[model samples]
Target: MTLSVTPPGTSSGPRSGHRLAVRPTRRVVAPEVRRRRRVQLTWALMVLNVMTFFPGAPHLLPIPGSVGKLIAQGALVGALVMALSVNRPLRVRPSVYVVILMTLAVEALLSSLHAEFLLGALFRACRLFGFALVLWLLTPWWTRRDLLLVRTHLLMLWGIVASVVVGLAVAPGLAMTEDRLGGTLWPIPPTQVGHYSAVAIGLTIVLWMSGLLRRSVALVSVLVCVPVLLLTHTRTALVAVLAGVTLAGISLFTARSRVRKAFAIGLVVFTLGDLTLGSVVTTWLARGQDTAELGALTGRKAVWEAILAQPRSAMEVLFGFGLSNKSFNGLPIDSNWLGTYYDVGLVGCALTVMLVLFVLVAAWFRPQGPHRALALFLVAYCVVASFTESGLSEASPYLLELTLAASLVYSTPTREGPR
Candidate 1:
């Protein structure tokens, strides 16, 4: 028997009831749509990750107190999953800032060997390690997707800000204690509420000036966030917001016409505010504190002196007593450098200094853009706030903000000339 061959130019039909195989055409998604999807996914995961760290979140949402530990761990697990899901291999240089943070995490674990509260310190150290690991694991995506990374970060921040506002409206009495705002629902410290508001407001202005966000939106954010910020009566947050926004906006003035116009309008608004609200503002800043208390930096100076005066072993001075409750004799340290030293000692303090300085120097040289402006604002805010509040060397909002800034700096393509 002989097989028949199909002739050239002849249409071939199925033989022996066998169908020809067909390769399906793949659907092509638009670049913008894909970017948006990535950003949204990142935003959701970031919200979960950030919620774990936000001062009052675990105390209120998804369960409170001891049960909150599970939620925090789950969030990190989700972050690890997200980080491992990157579609492509990263080819960027290793981020020095990230390395330093990872080092700090290892140091924290080492320092915790003799902590006063062994369990608490170990738990905190583990969380710090998880945070650093998540950040490092996601570096490939964050470095190439800078725009999406920061946009998602801002969205996470705004979510917290909105929660505080809603909490205030829902229960003014619970939100305000002694005239200070701390959402009754979340029950966060008034200072944390103020921190979120101040950061949101500052970043909104910077993103707006950089044309990343709309003017109307930024204006609305400031209008809403300011009230929450003011109600918290957190003078440190207020000062930091002013300094951060001012420095960030300055970077955009030359490139963005809106910045100059806004600056002029702001000057006018400030002048009128000084004229009409000068006494009120001054009184509020005073917060009923006497000169002696104010001179002592609201009693922080004494705490600093006490910390410094306390004798320490050679190893203790070098490594510290390990992380505690971030307090001294039942009182909060209220200072980043001091707290870092108390928790991790002089070595931790040096690493913390490097963390801030590296970001500061990178933002100084980075090309002017929304990312740089944001980096500038976050770094400046952390710097100002560090002197008055702790958390620079630990898994806190300030640490996250600094890490975000570092990612922005490293993710950006560098120029031949420094800004």
Candidate 2:
């Protein structure tokens, strides 16, 4: 709730031209407005916080990565102050996810006790804990139609998209490395650009089909995001988007829904893609890699084998080697399960498995609706991407997106609003 102080002239003005009124009247703000603002601020803070993950090298800000992270944290603090201005603290749902994430964060903190890079590991744990705390604070708005949070997230994504596009136009060579597009100005990886763009496209299309997003807005989002995604040449994101949308769109096949329009559009896209760029698409997917490299998952197999071959104590196996920039021997461990296992150990891996499984099971029983569609898309994309991308048990965008799906599944609204 918000406080609106009555004007001094009305509340503290002379009364009967004698005694002065001492107290100003307080007016309660609408619950919906308060909730909306709280959710938006909380979500926005989380979005800004994600920026800390990227290294600020050759960045637009021209500052050290640590300094950039501090600036991001400053924004986080500001958003926290605003989010806490409400009348009461929000409560989290009784989700297994709560237990899982708390345990993971605690494990991370404890791992820092024995880690080589003490500060790095501790800060990593803090980021996870902070996000979990924010999720708890956002419980009040976890509803089917919590469009306030969704709109804020979409706006943030659009800003990212626009920034990358600007970077492309301003510095094409820096943005495009070997024909793979990245956010040169912002310093995002090509895979990250593709992932975000794929998410925006999939969510926009699904939301539009569900009648929650305007046709024009959705069209623009897809038209803008799809090109960015394609330019990144991220096969994982491309396949994930197709899989997610196709699976989520199943509910719209009903007679009352706009299935025909969606199907027609899909058909057109597929036909055009096949006729116009089938060979080009194949070459892009190849990425100039040979059969051996392709089969080895771009040399990821060697890294995975090396990670597994490393000798570790039983304690290390249970808790892990602790977070070290999500890398090992100067190579990135891109697989989610392997990365989580290495950073947080077998226990973290078990928790990550439980988290994803719980959501998938819960979504399986959810009735047909926009909420289920989103849940399906988010989970499906993450599941597909996990084999290649890390962040299932860490403070990254994948985990954040999965947390959103968990909220949709666990939220218990007393009354159903219009779709």
Could you list the CA RMSD of all candidates, in the order they appear?
A: 6.9, 7.2
Off by over 4 Å in 2: 1-31, 53-58, 75-80, 87-90, 414-419
Count clashing residue pairs per candidate.
Answer: 0, 0
In angstroms, the error of model 2 at 56 is 6.1
The 10-residue segment of model 2 with minimum total lDDT is 410-419
lDDT per residue as tens, model 2, 1-419:
98877875676345676875479879888776665666677777787777653673334546667766786766556666655564254444566877887888888778767888888888788777777766665655566465555567778888888988998888888788778888866678889889889988888987887888888898889889999998999999999999988878875567325756778887999999999999998898999999998999998899899999989999999999887677778888889989888888999898899989988888778877777887888899999999998988877788888888887776554332211
Clash pairs of candidate 2? none
Residue lDDT tens for model 1, 49-164: 54433444323344455555465557767765655544234333478988899899999999998988899999888878887876775555455433666667667777777887
Model 1 C-alpha RMSD to native: 6.9
The C-alpha lDDT values of all candidates are 0.79, 0.78
Give residue 415's error in model 2 in angstroms.
7.4
How close is every model to the real structure, measured as TM-score? 0.84, 0.86
